[model samples]
Target: MNPTPATSLSALREVLPQLAHPDGSPVRALVVDDEPMLADLVSMGLSLCGWEVRVAHAGRAAVEAARGFVPDVLVLDWMLPELDGIEVLAKVRSFRPGIPALMLTARDSVDDRIRGLAAGGDDYVTKPFSLEEVLIRLHRLVQRTGVMALDADELVVGDLSLNVRTREVSRGGEAIELTTTQFNLLQYLMENPRAVLSKAQILDHVWDYDFGGQANIVELYISYLRKRIDAGRVPMIHTVRGAGYVIRPA
Candidate 1:
């Protein structure tokens, strides 16, 4: 007899331990696709891999979700009803510049892939992709971004100070402690201060991958940093509408 839904859920839970973060937080992902069945399939597969997944059917909805849901990775389709994947990515980058975004599309030409990457895609997966490959790539991206050790040397943006190696952050002389992911994400932003970097660009440089996961991960970490580093303080990380992020002194 086939297992009941509860039994299947329990079985899935048992496997979650193997895929969960060391601290037990569920990895989060967003899926954007115009095709309902394809989006469902992608969400289900990612859920099976222990990701908390959400789906959006249009580019505009995807952008709105990126701001609120703040997923760690985005599985985005190249074509959409209104804005298209490129437009969605551009908008997401404006709010949270360093999120990791994976592009999914039926277009397989080299030029098309280049265009996607140039438009803020960390990675691209063509249609008819293997589920296993997607899982592996996503796993690699999450592990790399979420688990890196930062340098303890101090980083300065005018009077603001951030120590990547020690996970200590401060403005002027006051000190702060940041989560591992937050520290790394902030360090990357500060390191490239004054330069506008999109979420995909951040993922490519900091996470050191071409693609695999949700772009909103950058936004989530940025939120963490804002609370820890910029909250109650003058804003330094500024958003450029329809562009990306730039860190500049107030």
Candidate 2:
């Protein structure tokens, strides 16, 4: 039997990990579909999963939204009026460049899929798709192109070095053993060194959107990180008092 909407939503939460702005804000998404009902449906579902969503009903409006929304992902319909999906994708690409896009359309043929992929759609879904399928595809797309898609294999902040390709972390040439969660959390901080990140921000980026744990969980992990990453070394992870946490040179 097909899953219920609530079941599908729960599956989506399992698939798409929470991604937050450095300040721990919800990850932004832009939905471009002339069909108001469909657009609103997607927006509402994603919003329930903690995404900050925006909608654009026209190709031009979609392109304009990309400029300011800076969406982490774009859900675009292929047969848009005025600009068509390909043209809108191309135009948005000039600005967003590597932003991931999922192309939606009634076109299910191989040729149509190829054209959409060539036009820079990261994923594609045919019309009459279930919301569950859309959410699953979206999760895979973000995993492929979002935070995990590093431009460089190695990340460096002061004496700290993280090899993205190797999943390795070291400080001052000494290897550091970190749990998978710790590793991901450290990578997030390393990516945005010197930025004071609040607990909400950390949870959003490092945990699942549906995470029900207390915010102090962030404090617990931060303490764990300090023990493994700092200990005797010159501390790089710092608390900003009323602010949050920052990773920078001592």
Candidate 3:
């Protein structure tokens, strides 16, 4: 049966911004999921980030792909036919012990999360997740591994610079002070650059996942950020009318 064209994942995908390896070398990724369409969607997203990606629908295939591809990062789904994600992760770890991995699971239990992490998963995401989340999490995971030898800590958008380690944000030649929450919101915005982020997305990322509050809190924080970072200068924080907020180069 053909899915409605407009409702398919392919149709939902927009022109994603590109993210690249710092060394100008090619970055490879392995996406393991039994769901063919989900795997394909994820592969597409990673490819858009200018990374080479391989998709494996089963656990054995995942391990073989890992051996041959030597991917910089792995996105593994917890459930699969034949061998499960944990089994695949264990087998892959045998050879690529230091390889960073992100686990995707439908289970939300604390035990499940701990098991995946104890099994060598460097990060975790639940199923029905956004492709953007996968891309960002995997990007962070790869950076943490130091295999890419990239300057993954510092970020710059035009004149605004953010140092993840120092927690310092600077505008042009001047330093800007920010609260922890404000800093996190700005960091997420800087990570995405020109892309518009919805309030819900911002809440999920900048705020805690279980942060049961309204979008007003995001707006309140954005205002605080604007006052501290953008006031009396070329504004970097912008509101997209009915959409959401974005931080562009000032």
Candidate 4:
């Protein structure tokens, strides 16, 4: 049973609730895929995540969409008619310079991946992929680019600061060592400061929808974050008992 656009979007929201940006606007995305079903599916999923998505089935259409849509991220398919993915990426970057793009292809070779990155893609995904993987990668790209930021390079809660550009975390002017996962988790929490986010919400943003391991993984990571970000400090990260966690200046 194939899902209709409405149903697909609804399922996506059930798994990963889509919250509006801090500024109350949807993040915009440009999805370029030749296959109608795949493109529609991806678009619907993104839309469910509060992203304003525009679909382009061809390389030329993708380039055109970038001009008008001005998306924060671009999900491009490698094989396309009228200018391959690489060429389309080149043109888009020429004007939009540094706009993050995730290239999707059936090409799984190391050399192919390198070429895609060298040709101006921030990330690459091979076909037979999970929609969750795509969404996660897109989130990472957006975070790294500060696409959701409200015109700021730093997100601060209390004395803690997460530098969107340098990818640095510091509390009370002291550098805090964090792994990539820890950094991402902390960033998510700090981005929505004072908001009580549920465990499911944390997992959806920090981990993936298909995380088949222990359900305590979110708790484990929260502990990991506390150790680094809250251990010796004033403890900005707090457990809300029945609710999830929230980062607020204590």
Candidate 5:
């Protein structure tokens, strides 16, 4: 039987019990594909599986949606209009590094997959994929990274402070409201302050097993963290070109 919208929602509801939630917050996802029908199917499948899903038909639009959607995961097609998936992924990495991104493409060549990963994609799914496989992969990815949980005791950086248990962040005694992922990435950076941590290293510590080998994701997330944590304040996180990252007082 073809899965209508109602049937899809019902199926998703049935699987809700098996899926885990992020401490009661809805799991958000962004799907980027030029093919509207394909994007809709993927969105419906994800929605049924208990994800809050949004779709973008082009790379530029995908970036715009991400600012508001703040998606925990991004399902990006390799080929896109205006900007290709790789370009979109690059732009996203500039803004939200460490957010897991799964690439969808009809191109199954090893070179293509390698290019995607090198560009900062966390995972790759070729076209004609099985819904079951995507769901399982996403679950594993989320579980491995633990990106949803924000109940840690505390995060500290050179006298700066973030109490995860209290959801409070302070630099020089001033409080900050960091989104869940930002907090996690910042915490990881603070924990390894002064170490030239690479993007891959950050992704491994911050995202799930489904994270691709691309390093740009780390760069993007660092920018997001810096904007919130260092914009008008002293810089705490610094990027080393051709190397990785280091955290220190500015």
Candidate 6:
């Protein structure tokens, strides 16, 4: 009952990142947690994000909701009355393999993280978490799923643009060429404008690479993107010290 959620809807809206389906529909979200208060809170918070949301209290109910709701993202609690979150995740993913799932739990051990992720959870949130944290994580998860987008064909921030279909990029009406890796990196940055993306996130989404050892690849590609995307223009991409990179209007 002591959930540390954002103080007000205004605060949530101000801090929360905006996401949209390419078709201009609200994001569909499913909340599965046996704790009624927690479930309700998450459902309400997601609704405030302008998402279409459904809540379930148990694993079986979660799967049923997954079928009827056909949610685009899932916030699933690991321990459930009947089937547990891992089982529910598998069942839901059987029909919707590409759906992004964020697992909720009190267990913070490395083993559990590995287990949840191995079982197809796209992200993990420890218990006693804030609604803001969950909201931010959900934004990252949906973006990684390749479903949430600013527009169907292109993502734009100020004059910077990336065409998802044609793989073309431009800034201030000038064509900018990029290599395949650099293009993917810039595309990811453009997709989540104004949101800080960690190097680990960049590797996972842009390269599908493991978060460790090869993180330098992200930095390298980012530098390449800057040289091309920001050359002779006001910079659109920025680095958040100790956090990650974000793209926004100059």
Steric collisions counted per model: 17, 1, 0, 0, 11, 0
lDDT of 1 by residue, 1-250 (tens): 1212445545544543233332446777889999898888778767765579899999889999989998878889988988899898889888887778889899899999999998888888998776655666776555434322122365566457666556677776788787666777778887665678888887887677665675777677767777877788887777787677777654
Each model's lDDT: 0.73, 0.80, 0.77, 0.79, 0.74, 0.81
Candidate 4: how many backbone clashes?
0
Model 6: what TM-score? 0.61
Better of 3 and 6 by TM-score: 6
Worst 10 residues of 1 by lDDT: 143-152
| Candidate that would win on TM-score | 6
lDDT of 5 by residue, 1-250 (tens): 1344566456645553333343456678899999999889878777776678999999899999998888878899988988998888778777887778888889899998898888888788897876666766775555434333222465444446667568788877777888888888887776555578877778888885445756667778888888887888767778798888887644
TM accuracy, model 1: 0.53
Could you say which candidate leads in lDDT? 6
Q: What's the best-to-worst order under TM-score? A: 6, 2, 4, 5, 3, 1
Tens digits of per-residue lDDT, candidate 2, 1-250, equal: 1333776687777655554544456767899999898898888778876778999999999999999888889999998888998898889889778778999888899999998998788889888888877876775565434233223666666567788789999887899989998998998898786678888788899985444666788889999999999999888899998888998754
Better by lDDT, candidate 5 or 3: 3
Per-model TM values vs. the true structure: 0.53, 0.59, 0.53, 0.57, 0.54, 0.61
- State the displacement of the C-alpha of residue 2, model 4, in Å, after optimal TM-score superposition: 11
lDDT of 5 at 118: 87
TM-score of 4: 0.57
Candidate 4 ranges beyond 4 A from true positions: 1-22, 149-250
Kindly indicate the candidate among 1 and 4 with the higher TM-score.
4
